[model samples]
Target: MAEAFERGGQQAWFHDHGHWGVFFHTYDNFQLSGFGEHFDQPRKIHVFIPRDYEVSPDRYSVLYCNDGDDIFFGDGETEQSWQVAEKLSQLYLRDQLKKIIVVAICSGDRHYEYSHIPEDDGGLEEYSRYLAKGLKPFIDENYRTIPHSTVILGASRGGLAAFYTACKHPRQFPQVATLSPSFWLGLDSPSYSMSNLDKAFKIKLQNSALMFALTSTLLEPDLRPKIYLDWGLRDDPGNEYEIRSQCRCMEMIQVLTTEFDYQEDHNLFIVEDPNGSHSINSWGDRLPNILQLFFD
Candidate 1:
């Protein structure tokens, strides 16, 4: 049910001199078969350890992300990545954040599993198991990672998956950051992805909020895990009347808080990039700050 694959020795599109000490390992969740027979490349996941890791080789926090191919690394030049490796490299050098391990789990037929739909593959627990259960243990064994200090992250569509991952498995990944989650994927009209987020946090917070921390499994009675939500307000090229309503998303979240009765101040944060748009550059510019607020 668990195996480690490798994309070793292949030409990398985003690997550059500045991305020093970066080592990658390929992984796949081939056992995860939702589409049945038609599914290919099932066990594909990537582990990205920073250059600093070799020198320190100490236990570090782990951040798991979706969109494995494009987030931490890219498939080709035109498919530019989020450049997180370099960004973290600079930050680590300047001491903006501590060194951490980033595990990117690729999404095969992501549209199905990344969604909440019951019938589709996105809810494919097989892939999730390979990461949260199988692959993660492998990472813990090989790399110097804090027993659990695992943080789950995702952007755009990946964002929604990150949140869902945290919500369902609060004990494993207590802290989560979603940068413009593609919540709109499974939602209906008059309600967007933001609506889904509203329900998740409001209804799902544990008592201790310390689930993601290495030492904690339960959020304190009044305690809650740090949650970060970032969204930009800009006219999406594809959607006309559907320009992302960042403000409305915030409003919906706030309303959910009141209705759900969770700690308003401690549970959630909605950061707005007022002048920002929807793009890697936009999300990248704010990644470090979000890390500080949530994972630091």
Candidate 2:
């Protein structure tokens, strides 16, 4: 049997495989032209709604994830993904997670879209606006989502974008998860060394905008969003481009804890996986834990 629903420009198909079911939808050619000049391109939005969605009257929480294609399909290069739909089904069946809707936004020019530093072309601001102003409202209006229960999540450069977007619009996205964010983008590092710690720390200190964001959260603790951050200890400096990812992740933790006064395992949780790496497989393995932190 087949059933379907449509809302605004979005459409969903109910797939029942006897034992279980899932609602898959595609928002094809989702345009970002109204948000900013830099975001004139169109992107696809892949949404997953649980099988019981149509019959259940309960509103669901929303998880907006970046790198939509990779989150579901496993980046073609790595042959791995968060396997979000499969994981969600398992958790729902086990009653470990509350019913939640997941939306993954495909990326266009990832570096330009995710970076905080403005390339001569564009930067995080345009992308944040697209999420906060453009895409979010559409989802809210079309789906049965609790207003304050929404969370935004991403990994790597996309992770940086997730945090940055939440920081910019805490009222819109009050909860965020970042998996190994590329926080070293605005700094310069020729090589990694134990000696580079002080230098790297100093460079991050000079990031006035980042400092202000963290400090502002401290100043108004009540309005601060719950945050989840994770980094793999095994994300070694052996990789040339990511040599600073681990160091910067530590710096981010330090600033959030010391400067922002975000308590560990409280409103803020940071997980360091001794065996983790900078790969989707690693992030996928940690998704269950991450979702529990956000939804539980």
The best candidate in terms of lDDT: 2
lDDT accuracy of residue 57 in candidate 1: 44
True lDDT of residue 274, candidate 1? 73
Task: Show where candidate 1 strays beyond 4 Å.
Answer: 1-18, 28-41, 55-57, 76-78, 119-127, 189-225, 236-242, 245-248
Provide the clash count, candidate 1. 25
Give the C-alpha lDDT of model 2: 0.76
Per-residue lDDT of model 2, residues 174-290, tens digit only: 999998887776665545465556765577643645555445654578787788888877746564334356677777777777867778888788888787888888888899898
lDDT of each: 0.60, 0.76
Task: List, residue by residue over 76-192, the lDDT tens digit for candidate 1.
Answer: 233767777877777877877877778877666767667654544445444444456655666677678885588888876677677666655566777788887655443334343
Question: Model 2: what TM-score?
Answer: 0.87
Clashing pairs in 2: 74-80
RMSD of each: 7.4, 3.0
Clashes of each: 25, 1
